[model samples]
Target: MAADLVSRVKTDPNFIELEAKRGAFGWTIAISMVVIYFAFIFMVAFFKDALSVQVYGVITLAFPLGILVLFSAFVLVGIYVVRANGEFDDLTKKIVEKAR
Candidate 1:
């Protein structure tokens, strides 16, 4: 069945194009996220003192805020994973079926 599907994909131009487009979009999102996250870290490191603020009317909050932002990136990645696995996986399955 797998071999049959592979043969069909090879013969189906639409399936091939959809697969390529999906791959490109996924990679683009991944790379953009990595670059933006690193840039945020670099910015925070360079401007820590400038951005620091007292919280609860006492403790400094700069470090905590930075950590929160970093943690939120992981949350964003989780969302990306859910969307990609749910939507993109379905799209790929459809393409494969059509190819087959």
Candidate 2:
């Protein structure tokens, strides 16, 4: 019975839509994060002199860029959570209901 229900859900249109949407959205977020992180890493590796420049008293330019990279992860997760709770959850509910 469980297998049958799972098969039915897999064949459902909502399931397909959910899979495609989730996959694409996940990839987009992952790629964005990778680019942002790598850009910071590259800057640190290749542009130490620039990062070492004084931004304010006792603060270097690298300080804010590092903070931004950390905060960007949190912000991206928050965005994913919002979308998952809204669109993804709705599609999931529909798929389960249809399976039943």
Candidate 3:
């Protein structure tokens, strides 16, 4: 049964399209997050003095930038959830129905 399903899946254009779209979107999101995270790490490692410098009276640039990084994680997760629940879920349901 599983083999038959796999055969059907392999031949289906919709399956191919879905895989392509999902792979592309997943990789894009993954790469973006990695770049954002590594950028913060790199900044911390190489530009320690800049991050240490006071932005206002007492608050430093590092504090705000660190907060921005944390905020960005939540924002990125929201983005993925929206896409997965909406577009990706719709496509997945369509494919499953066709398989059935």
Give the best candidate by lDDT.
2
Model 1: residues with Cα > 4 Å off, grouped in runs = 1-28
* Candidate 2, superposed: residue stretches over 4 Å from native: 1-7
lDDT of 1 by residue, 1-34 (tens): 5887678777677666656766787787678778
lDDT by residue for model 3 (4-82), tens: 9989977788778878887898888888889999999999999999999998999999999999989888888888889
Candidate 2 residue lDDT tens string, 6-97: 78888899999999999999999999999999999999999999999999998999999999999999999999999999999999999877
Task: Output the lDDT of residue 25, model 3.
Answer: 84
Error of 2 at 97 (Å): 0.6
Q: Which candidate achieves the best TM-score against the true structure?
A: 3
Q: What's each prediction's clash count? A: 0, 0, 0
lDDT-based ranking: 2, 3, 1
* Residue 40 Cα positional deviation in candidate 2, in Å, after optimal superposition: 0.9
Q: Which of 1 and 3 is ahead in lDDT?
A: 3
